[model samples]
Target: MMPMTITEIAEAVGGTVTAPFAGEHAGGVPDGEVARSATSDSRLVGEGGVFVAIKGERVDGHDYVAGLGAKGAAAAIVDHAVSDADVTQIVVDDTVEALGALARHNIERRRADAGKPFTLVALTGSVGKTTTKDLLKSLLSTLDETVAPVGSFNNEIGLPLTALTVNADTRYFVAEMGANHVGEIARLTTIAPPDIAIVLKVGVAHLGEFGSVERIAQAKSEIVRGLLPSGTAVLNADDAHVAAMRSIAPADVVWFGIDPAHADEDALTVRELTTDDMDHPSFTLVAANGDTADVRLAIPGAHNAMNALAASTVAHMLGMPLDDIARVLGEQRRISPHRMAVSTVERDGAVFTLIDDSFNANPDSMRAGLDGLARWGAGRKTQPYRVAVLGAMLELGGDEQGLHRSIGAYAAELGLDRIVAVGSATDAEFDALAGALAEGACTAIASRGGTAAVDWVHDADEADRLVTSIASEHPGTVALLKGSHASGLSTLAERWAPADPARR
Candidate 1:
């Protein structure tokens, strides 16, 4: 981050400096100025960095203002509502809002100074933002040094943090944006707004927070609201939540879908992508200008083939070579920790393979992970069982039970050797599915705990304890462990992976 003056930051956000700490003159700092870039916690205060004393929901950042100032934080930007009598402070209506205002100003200044405005790709969706970002970064890297938002840092605070991470050297910035409400994405767009926006697919995500699917779509369209007037959008033509948003997009739009099954031959992007018998889709990607790229996504699931296509579509538009885009995809498909990361465990002579898709989940992603598990475990017939340990899918609003049952039905249709649906809602659905599924091939066990499947049908818990018992006792099975972030299923994925003693 750079250096900026207290007065300059105050003026930009319509804030007032209530007191003075020291002389404001940034010499060695980065964009830590009022009309300039932001500095860091330890940057020279004399080098002019603005200190935002944010009041978090639980912890007040204002409490650390003096400590930060002592560490060379230039000026303190605080809330007018905060009554700090002795120390120097810049008063704003809301400190967090002021920080956002600072981000917008810095973004605008960057635009003004650049000889050419670099393209911004704002990506958002439930299942594939990080994967999409990885794919996009891979394709774009072939063209130039690209900077993408690290991990899932796409929220209000994260967006600014990501923006500050971007400097003049970044030829392209791929901002991964996320939202759980109607107005959240809109607020994020006001900062790292995009030149091209991709709304991947809205699923039963954050239903626990935002209320409904339609409302989720409405929230995601705020990305469209953030695009430049002449910018373009790449959308999932198959998603009703995404498709219905065309009317709201004020820019050019390109539709991408996985349906080669459709009779319409004139689609923007379409390919005959298919998953393996275990459900990993490998397909060639046909780009915009009749150019075809052989896309082999290391990430399983047909949904990711869709994700790869979304990345390639933008790459095609940007003039990336078809071959370069395909070659680097393997390097780019690095799924961050806890997100569909596959590993193995060696317990005695048995091979305990675990597929960890625990970072987050909705029905769409849960299904996708199941497909991946099937693909990775396709040829392992010697493994005693194909087990699925699934936690409850939260926030389906009023239809949580039905949603869980539907997931169970999907599990039943998959013909796994044993299925354990954990948590109350999903357990009920698993029971419903168990009763409905023909007996002979698969067993469906639903419980609020792992003991039910783990201990002759004990109830309580998500996939956590379910996988534990399955792997510990019967080390000869392919296990698919999944749950939302709240359930912390990544730990289980690690437990089954190599060197953990299970797969020894």
Candidate 2:
């Protein structure tokens, strides 16, 4: 973050200075005492960093402000001043809003720096936003310094905290915008407006909150609407809802997708797209200018082909060559945790491939993950025992049961050897949703003449026992873990494939 004095920060956030450090002046902190960064998490606060004390239901950040001086913190932004603490305090009505203001001030300072101007690229979607953000970060970093969020930090507080991390030498800021409502993305846009905006897809991830897919489309379009007048919009041409955004875009739009029907001379499209046995996509990245490069993504999933193309489009717009884009893309072997993350697991002398896509789930992403599983099984020399341990996909509106069942049917239709629908043992509602999934799979199996086994377990423990049983019986087995965050399947995935601490 650009350095800002305590007085400048308090003025930026409309806050009052209180609880000045003992060594500091009574009126205010001196100009030499400045905060170099901003963070809401007290544990992550560094010396010379400004801590934003946000009050949450479980934890009140104001409680930690009194100790900032001992940690060498420059100051604390809180709703109420902590008189006990020796650190400088900027008292405000709302610390979250103050953090946003500080971030906005930091970004404006960077933009006005003249010597080091940075391009801010923002993206939003129902799915693939983080994966695409990681891809774009990788591609952009190959050219110059880039800053992006840690994970799915795309909300109000997350976006601002990410924006504040930008410094003078940072050449690119890849902001991932996410919202369950119509105005959330627009609100975030006010904090860090993008020079180039991207809309990945308009799917049904947050159908319950937004009410309809059309409303979700409208919510996703805010990124394009929030772009600077001279900015560029990178949109997915494959999704009809996303494609329609071109009509409402505030600036020139650049299209990227796998579909040729939506492509024009200026759009980037994929050709001869295909995924390997592990679901790694290899495609010809074709540009509007006739420049082409063969891109073989190391990440697992055919769905990522569009994501890669979207990142390539942004890099291309930023003057990166197609060869460089392809090279950077191919070098990315992983993304944020638990999204189509592939690993090996051994249980009772049996081994299997684990596709840990348990980060979060929706109908679109579930189907995409199942497709990857089907391809992984089909590509093997010998047929591997395929099992899909699916948990309930939440926030799907009133048709939540139908959505769960449809996912089950999709796995059955894919000829998976086993379908385990997992739900909470203690939660009756989630158990019913899992039952619906199993019922759909059972119906599909009975009618389709497949020997697939469908079972609805109460929780991840039961699902793990069943998968381990299958692993013991079959030496070559492949398991897919897909679920919403509430389903807790990600925990099971972590147990199955614990992250390598050396790499972390």
Candidate 3:
């Protein structure tokens, strides 16, 4: 963040300085009294940091204003004034709006100071935004000082906080934009308009909120509409919904896809796609200029190959040679947690493979994860028994039950050795839907005379117990835990794969 005095901050956010220097002010807050960083969490406040007090569902940050002085905060931006704390206060009508205002000011300042104006690249999609953003950050950092969010920080609050982190030396700003409704992304574009926009795929991840696939497509395309006049739109040519966005983009369009049939002469295409025993995809990356490179990803999933192509297209446009782009992508490992994170655990003389893709789930991501697990199990020398401990995919709307059942049936069809559906067994309100998911898989398996077993558990504890028992009985068992945020599958993964002391 750029250094700004309390006076400058007040001017930027339309706030007033109220304490410590309210009456002692020599015209305005001293230029030396500056905040070097901004945060909404008081616990993260450092010396010379400005704390913005935001009221959340459970905790009101205004309640912590009295303690900022002890924590070395330079000033507090609050909706109300605090009398007890011996700290400078910037009183604004709304802290969130003030935060956006300050972020816009910082971005404008950085652009004016940059010798080469920093490029803003924004991406939105149903499933691959975070993973693709991580890949882009890794590739861009090889060429310039890049600023991208930590993990899944794509919403309103997270986006502005990320934008504010940019400074004069920052050359690339990669913003991951996400939305649950129609106008969310459009509002975000007003904060940090993109010079380049990427639309990965239009899927059913937020079907509940938007109500239909068409509405979801409309929400995702807001980023492209928000692009600058001279911006570049990098689109996924394979997705019909995403491909249609070319008509509305007000800038030059570049395409990336795995299927050659979807590619035009100017598109980056992937050919001869194949996965290794661990399910890591390798393919020939053919760029727009016909320069080709053999690319293999360290991440374990065939789905990630498409994400790699999206990142590679962005890197190629930014002047990274095709060979260098492939090398950087091939060397990159998992940057974010709980997305295709593979680990081994030894317990009671039994070794198990844990594929934890439990960060968030929808029908599309769930299918990709299951496919990766099936492939991985088939390629193992010992023929590891595959178990899927999946939680309910939330916010699927009126067809939620049907979608869950379809996912369950799909798992059975994959010939997985076992399936465990996680949900609240005791909660009468949730049992119907959760039970349907379990019954759907069991019925499908029985109908096909498949040997795969199905189990339904109320919570993560029961799911973990069942998985441990299966691993004990079958030493080479491999399990995939995929679920939405409410399922708490990520907590279970941490229990199974705690950090190793030797590696630490």
TM-score of each: 0.80, 0.97, 0.95
Top model number, TM-score:
2
Candidate number that wins on TM-score, 1 or 3: 3
* lDDT of each residue in 266-302, candidate 1, tens digit only: 2345566766544455677665456676656666566
Q: Which candidate number maximizes lDDT?
A: 2
Candidate 1: where are CA atoms >4 Å away? 1-3, 18-51, 80-89, 261-272, 275-280, 346-351, 380-384, 424-469, 472-476, 488-504
Q: Native-vs-model 1 lDDT? A: 0.65
- Against the reference, the lDDT scores of all candidates come to 0.65, 0.87, 0.86
- Whole-model lDDT, model 3: 0.86
Over 377-398, each residue of candidate 2 has an lDDT whose tens digit, in order, gives 5766798888899988888899
Q: In model 3, where do residues sit more than 4 Å from their true spots?
A: 21-28, 425-431, 501-504
RMSD of 2: 2.0
Candidate 1 lDDT trough over 10 residues, lowest sum: 447-456
Query: Which sequence of candidate numbers ranks them by TM-score, best first?
Result: 2, 3, 1
RMSD in Å for candidate 1, one decimal? 5.7
Error of 3 at 30 (Å): 3.7
